[model samples]
Target: MAVGELSEKRPTRYEIEDVEAADRRSRWRFRILFAVVWLGLIIGLAVGLALTGRIDPAFILEVGPFILDGTPTTLLICFSSILLACVLATLGALGRLSGNPVLNAIASFYVSLLRGTPLVVQILFWYLALPQFGVVLDALPAGIGALAFNYGAYMTEIFRAGVEAVPRGQQEAARALGMRESEVMRRIVFPQALRIVTPAIGNEFIAMIKDSALVYLLGVREVLWRADVMGTRFFRSTETLLIAAVVYWILTIVLSFFQERLERRMARGDR
Candidate 1:
């Protein structure tokens, strides 16, 4: 091959850096444009609602703080529930993958039952129906339990897949080193499995944040519950509900941004 032709094909280090810089610049430009457009649309909607007398600026100012006060509770529920779900999912995955028929059957039944029932019903069951059987739970605990149980069942499959995705050779090598099965899983398999399913866990967490609003039905005083109370009191349901919706939307966007950053960091290991 000619030297000039080889040089043209391979590209110099400086040339490669220049191309990467240009690409990054282009991406940033598009991102800024998209943000501007999104803001414009939101502003346009607010103006239209105001002109139509569907929303009141003064009412929003008064009620916004009250609704926002519930943000901490909402976040508490989400974080607490996700932590519990992670534990349950890990155990459930093990049960599902166990060689013992009893363990497998229990895990299968748990997953099947939870996945079959609606989340709303499960929430109610914990908060309401359980009381009749003398197993009463407080509102916060009920909410957390329901959310954790429901999400754990779904996440079981994700965890199982992550565990199974670990190379068989690695487990064999661990066994050859005389590690017990439990030790091998704990030291070698589970860590890699957790990393593999992290993105899925992030997504489930985002969904759980939104689903946490359902706890309002149990009167947990979350964002939606607070908004509902204030809206009913003032007879400005539209304004209160819209503000709550915006809060949830903002939370979702913020969480999604962090999730993307986490995913990028995790992807670096692959490279």
Candidate 2:
């Protein structure tokens, strides 16, 4: 082949850079276009609802802050429940993994019983039925307890899987160093298991935020309950509920963004 012809066939460094830049520009354009389309759809829906008298802008403006006032309580419930769930889930995972028959059975039954039942029933049981057994709890505590217990059962498998993901060789190495089983688990196993499960824990935390709305049914006055009260009192149920829905949607989006970032950071080692 002629040297001139070979040079023409192969792109220069500047040409390759130009092509890469164009690809990035194309991707950014598509992202912006999609964002615009989504915004247009949401705006059109809001306008349509307003035209049909299905939503009230004035009512939303008046009541939005009132409903948002309950956000702290909602966050409190979610955070507290998740913390408690972490403790229970850790213990439950250990129990599930233990060779002892009694601990294994207790953990197995707990997971089965909680996971098999509706969360609403559990909430009601804690708040209402427990009173019959002289174990009465106020609405807030009852709601938190129910959420923690229910999520703990579900999270147990996540924790157990995380623990199992830790290589057996690592544990053996620790044992060779004269470490006891408990010390090995505490010093070598749990930390790595925690890193593996952090993403799943983040997902559960986001889910728990939404599930915290269920606590409103117990009259703990979270966002949904506050919305319901204002909606009923003002006869603008649609508007009030829409506001609450927006709040939850925003919360989910924000949390998901952080979760993505955390996952990316955690995955840097793999890259």
Candidate 3:
């Protein structure tokens, strides 16, 4: 192109630049507006609190423990229970896939029993009814066991899906290479299946964490129970609940972040 033609093209560059600038401005405008509205509301509240001499940002610190107790207890129960549940789920999946009718029936019944009853009922049954039969567990153990059994039933399906997703050709290839069926599964299929369902299984883990709070009904001293006790005793229902809400939000967010990273690593193995 001649110099004169190039000069004309430089003006088109400004047109493209203007479009890009406008796009960025549009994107940030609403974001800034959202921040402004929220900021104004918070500032207004703080000002009102100062005028009334009721402002104490540090006040929440005292109430935070009542909320954090349930979170830690909930986390511990969920982690332990979900760990056992995963193991049970793996066995159940294998049993369901087995050729033996006895094994299959046992696995099927386990799933049915857990799923058929309400989780709350099962918790009560384990905590209360078991005592009548001389099989009583402390509140924590009973709650954990109930959580595991219930989650195991759901995870059975996840594990089974993972197992079944393994391509038939991969199995045949393993067999043709003189690998035993069990070896083939252990070395090949299980790993892939695990990767395939990692995301779903992580979800189950987080769900287990939340459900652990239901154990409060059993009078366990977890976070929510602590929140209730503190709220009642201190007459700070709103503050106590806000603390618990923050705990749950933080826990879920931290867990989900790692789960996402784990999924990404698993996906990388595909390449």
Highest lDDT model number: 1
Q: Report the Cα lDDT for residue 175, model 3.
A: 95
Looking at model 1, report the run of 10 residues with the lowest lDDT sum. Answer: 11-20
lDDT of 3 by residue, 180-246 (tens): 9899999989988888888998999888767887898888988778877777897766666666766
Q: Give the TM-score (vs. native) of candidate 2.
A: 0.91
Please write out the lDDT profile of model 1 over residues 22-129, one tens digit for every residue. Answer: 999999999999999999998998888889977789999999999999999999999999999989888899999999999999999999999999999999999999
Please write out the lDDT profile of model 2 over residues 117-139, one tens digit for every residue. 99999999999999999998999
Report lDDT (Cα) of residue 217, candidate 1: 94
Judge candidate 1 against the unseen true structure and give its global Cα lDDT, from 0 to 1. Answer: 0.94
TM-score to native of every candidate shown: 0.89, 0.91, 0.79
- Count of clashes in candidate 1: 0
The Cα RMSD in angstroms, rounded to one decimal, for candidate 3 relative to the true structure is: 5.1
lDDT (CA) per prediction: 0.94, 0.93, 0.84
The candidate, 1 or 2, that scores higher on TM-score is: 2
lDDT, residue 51, candidate 1:
93
Off by over 4 Å in 3: 1-59
